[model samples]
Target chain A: MSSLAVGCRLRVAVLVLALLGAGAVGGGSTAHAADDGELTLDSIVNNVIVGHAEDGNYLNFDPFATVELPRIMVARTADGALTVDLYGSTKGLLKDGTYGLVPHSEGEGGHEEVITESSALQEAFASKAHLHGDIVRTSGHVVADLSITRHLIFGLLAMGIVLAIFLVLAQRYKRGVGRTEAPHGVLQNMMEVMVVFIRDEVAKPNIQGEKWRTFLPYLLSAFFFILMANILGLVPYAGAATSNIAVTGVLAVMTFVIGLLYGSKDHYKHMFLGPPDAPWPIRVILVPIELIGTVMRHLALAIRLFANMMGGSLIIFSLIGLVFIMNVLFGEAMAFGTSIISIGFTVFILLLKLLVAFIQAYVFTILSALFIGISVEEHEHEEHADDAHAEAPTSQTSGALSDRLDAVDDAVDDVTEPAPA
Target chain B: MTEVIAQSLVQPDVGLIFWKTIAFLIFLFLLYRYGWGPITEAMESREEEIESSIQRAEEALAEAKEIQSENKKARREAEREAQRILREARESAEELREEEMAKTRDRIQQMQEQAQAEIEREKQAALQELRDEVADLAIEAASKVVRDDLDGERQRKLVNDFIDDLPKN
Candidate 1:
């Protein structure tokens, strides 16, 4: 208990230190805010540029502040060519109520504003920018750059490399390469156990016979891919690709497709048209329910992965925001107190994020397996009914009894039948 | 027209880029190919090896137990055989001692009987010799008395009595 309290205290202390450090860095730069006529966080977010008439009116080049996002320049479509206009307050805006162009317009004076704010500008900004002819206009802060995107790609690539290395080592261990017997390395041993566990505990139970192996590759692939992606996202500056709805949606769709392709007729017929085992009245209500359920299950898969990753990031962001808010309201001392709490929460969330990553991956893989299993499941009652029809003409009328008998027969058939060609 | 054209531009839908799909496909393929297969297989084989090793150890233990039991039985059997041999030897020695004691008793009984017979024979001979000597003395004394007086009559009387007594014996 004492240890826990101490840990909590330490976390709070760290948060406070981080908050103070940020405040110090920011404060030192803005020490002369009165003289500079800039002090607020909003001004920093907007950025500013200064110029002096002294020294032959030379430009004072200093960015007031840089935002986390980049400025987005959207081009408009028109016959003359595309042109982008900057709006709102930014570093490019001059003190004389004008905007600066990136490249001076053909000697239109240095630091000249290409587009000025006016009544027409307000109207233009209200409507979604149009793309017509050769000109189209749209602009926003470009939060990501090529480097950021590359970093994300690199994160994914690094995970792939790690997985590849593990595979190579595992394969070598399996083949007994470079050793007289199975390698005793920790990695080799761990891999061996996981392989066996997945085969027996996961694949064997949920998947049937020779067919199980056929689907094993996809299931395993999904598991590791999602798992690695989730873990990578937890790293600082690494974007959670899986957190993106589109990414999770694509994976869910893939699972759905596999379920469709590999699933036996019984899956669709039983789920959609009602299983033979169900009573007529029950089937009437259940078939639709089951069909809807199938859709919901896959949908849930998408939401689960997306929500888990996205939720973790949002929580961390909120915690960080809390520190800044505290600093603004209660000054440095109270900010430190709050910073500790926030940072501790952030750390806790980070740990949980790690666990959630693995769990979500497992859940996705297992659910996918379940779907595949369900799809291919043979309705014993149906098979038994068929057999009863063949063996005894009156056997189908017994309803419940016949259903049970048919189920037995179907199960037997499932076991006896060879893999379909 | 140029001023109007310069005023507007459209943002590119980078989010909707087809490159995402391409990247996703590449990632999935690479991950499938290199990552999951061997790890799973390795884990499985490791478990199999451990299970088999345990089974082998158990079998060896059972075999060892069997050998030990067999050894114990053999040792017991050998001990029992040795005891049986000792018992037989002891019984034989006892029988030999009994036989020797019985022979010694018989010999002593025979010697005692022979000695009694010898003593009885000697006593009978002595008695017979004494009676003969006494009879001779009495006859001589009777002859002297008859010569002095009616010695013939006395000697005749004594001889007659002796003859009667001899006839009775």
Candidate 2:
């Protein structure tokens, strides 16, 4: 059979620069980058994370291509000597006879089996196979497979996208786009809605003393970065980095650290010492619970993001997989009939995934902001509490906006009424 | 085997995490420095401007209202002044008419008195003429009677007595 890996022609730079990869999962990949053989359920699902690597390094959904990234690995021989090496690609790595690729089925991870010879290696690098695998050393094993992954490349691409958007926006702001006047256009307006929402709806309400200002940059970055990544996931062949637990874990860990760094003395005290008023028995129980709770919540934070994104991708892949399964079971005509249902379900899920993308990004950032706010929150006696602090009015021209809107609405009606008449 | 796959799904890749930590740190730093600051500062600046603009608009509205009220008051004041002037004009016109009537009445009374005085003088003169004629008739009658009468002086004295005896009223 042809090489197992399947994909559309693509590159990170193009995705970053063009910022449009909707063609990845759509007609583009199916028409231009279709695999030579039939697709398997496992292969389709696995393809969500690992793009096809057969034709050097390629981004999955687009047509642009980049050179294969290097693989950095830790290997051990039968002598127990450890050596770290980098290769231009998996093909190059296998050429050394020092390391070989094993299919997940023959491997310990997903589908399993045994790999004995060069034939198995070829099978492992199937049309649906990825470079992320058990790389076996001759008579030894890969102690650490610290390879630069597809997800990592996408992650960097997502980052580059975020940087690109804001850099242009920063220039616009410097030229006084939203400053001297109200923001205009789709990009500015779209960005303003999120920024305003985060500030007024999320950050300000959580952080006190108007200290949301200090955390605004971090909050905005987290929101936009995750948002961009989540959006990129919806692009046909392009997926989200947040689908990986490692990426989300890093993000959560950042939240935990930031929370601690800016944490009030009382927060630490409350965590370790428990409520001072509680009896010693209760205190003993409460302290451990609080400590465990803190770690668990952050872990939960990471898993929640990963699971949601991963589930979405799985569903889409599975829905598409149904057609191929039908083709194998029945005939070509049935496959076409099955595609109708599959495409319908896929479209529905794609729509849901779009909404989910924004929600998950907002959720992660707001939660992080909340945790930080909690850490920095001051717990004081009721008698000493000040009640004067209230929500600052969001906009002075809130009424003006409506008034102007109404005026514009009337003006439009006036201008158009005569035409219809 | 399914469990292994399930476990692998969630298993965080160490290499990814290692790179992610460094990458995320840079992201936060670079974003804080470059991306977020200008955008947020501009927003805050715009917000302040809107607030001030609203304040200015409110002030302008109030000023306009005040000017309108003052204008209404002035208009009312002008109306009152006009009414007062009208009333005074009517009062002066009536006074002028009355004064003219009073002067005309005075002149008419004065003319009537002068005519009355001249009529009285003329009536006295006519009475004198009548008296003279009577005297001439008496003299002629006396001359005819003197042929059988006393003297002329006696006749004159008698007439004078008669005239004096007539009622002076």
Candidate 3:
């Protein structure tokens, strides 16, 4: 574990360097370093948004933008709160006068106007503190009446492409070309390795026969999807879409649903009423606890992914902010050292982030498989154990009965032998 | 701003952005139809191709093995043929040697027979000469003994007895 951690640290260093390099280019080109006092998620997200902003020229009323649409604007207020402003005009009627803020999540008329002047406007904007956004949004008549957060969209697209590539490679392997020797095509070969790795390393150990294959698709897809999303988020300007609680929650729920549906009768019964093997008193006490544990596990999956992504982003954001803060204290002379240190640490963290991204994905998939395995395990093993135990007593009784019979027969033989020949 | 917020608050509805859903669906549909299907089919076909190729390769290998076996059989047969020819030649050579040996034996037997016959003829000739000599001697002796007595009749009687006792040549 120490060696692994060291290696992980090295990787993190390299990753940080690469991310910093990317950030440097991005920051140098399209972003401005925050003035001395600013260091927050809101600022970073805002920088990313500002970097990707257009002059609002590409605006169209089409829900799905006609042409390639730029990313939405992300900005921060003076107090480090995040704002997501949809600033483009479309062909629709302009509802222009400055409007006050309202909290949509809360009921409309029941409470006081939650949308206060700056305060309510802030609610519309997601808080940088809690990763909330005060989103200024608009709708248009497009192919799809939805314009998702650019980060989510990118993540989705990336997932789709990655999935497609994997599927294609899988197809090629099935065709049976270059199988006898080593795999021929690079992608095909790599994919074969990955598939085997997931199946053996993740699925087979946890999941048993027929059911393993049945659940393999969902598990593999989820793992790959999360991985793609994570990597995409790592890219500057690309959002780590999985960081969104809703997305992760959905994925966790899917795992939960699968665990519920395909699970064995025993698993279901045990989940609610404890395992049949448990003592009567224990069963009464443990069933509810077990049920809660199941819920908590799935909930943990969601939180783990969400927290890890958000955490990585925050670290990187804070480190980069270190550069500007140092510039304020020691001027340009100390700025370079601070930049180097920031970049150095960032590079390391970034690498760990990469590993974390993959590890998390693996964990999610493996856990999903484990749940599936528990649900689908054959009852025969337990039954066999019971049978063996039962057989011991039966054999003993049968042996005693046979011995007694043999003794009686011997006695009869002795009596008959004397009068025989 | 308050009006805008209030209005949004009043209409706090999150509609399933139909266009977005449609777009996503289309994307999904395309992927399902074009991407996944082709990929899966390609895999299946690739598998089939590989399987057939392996089968064909196995078949070819089997054919090669068969041909090799046939060649081996033919080679063995050819070796047997050479062995048979060699054996036949050896047998013929043996037969010729036997015949020559028999002829040489016969020739020797003939020569021995000739020598034996010559020896027998010489002995018979010699015996004849001896008999002649004996006869002359007997006659001379008889003439000398019966010189004064009836010598002619007695000598004639002796000759007749000798002639009766002697074998014809």
Candidate achieving the largest lDDT: 2
DockQ of each: 0.07, 0.23, 0.10
- Residues A1-421, candidate 3: write the lDDT tens digits: 1334223322423333343454334333222332323542223333322212211122222344333242233445445555554424211111221222233322222443423354434434333211121223232111211234444465567667766786565455455453434457677666656656776787777776656766666676677777888887677645565665556766777788878888876567667876554568999888888888789878877776766665576567657765754454346887788798888977987787787777767767776776667666555444535844544543353245336435533543353231111
Superposed Cα RMSD, model 1 = 15.2
DockQ of 3: 0.10
How much is the lDDT of residue B163 in candidate 1?
55
Q: Please give the ranking of all candidate structures by lDDT, highest first, separated by commas.
A: 2, 3, 1
lDDT of model 1 at position A29: 35
Off by over 4 Å in 3: A1-147, A163-184, A381-421, B1-99, B112-169
Q: How far does residue A295 in candidate 3 sit from its true spot (Å)?
A: 0.8
Per DockQ, the best of the predicted structures is 2
At residue B139, candidate 3 shows an lDDT of 79
lDDT (0 to 1) per candidate: 0.53, 0.69, 0.55
- For model 2, residues B71-120, the per-residue Cα lDDT tens digits are 99999999999999999999999999999999999999999999999999
User: How badly does each model clash, as a count of residue pairs?
Assistant: 31, 17, 36
Q: Report the CAPRI category for model 2.
A: acceptable
TM-score, first chain, each model:
0.57, 0.72, 0.61
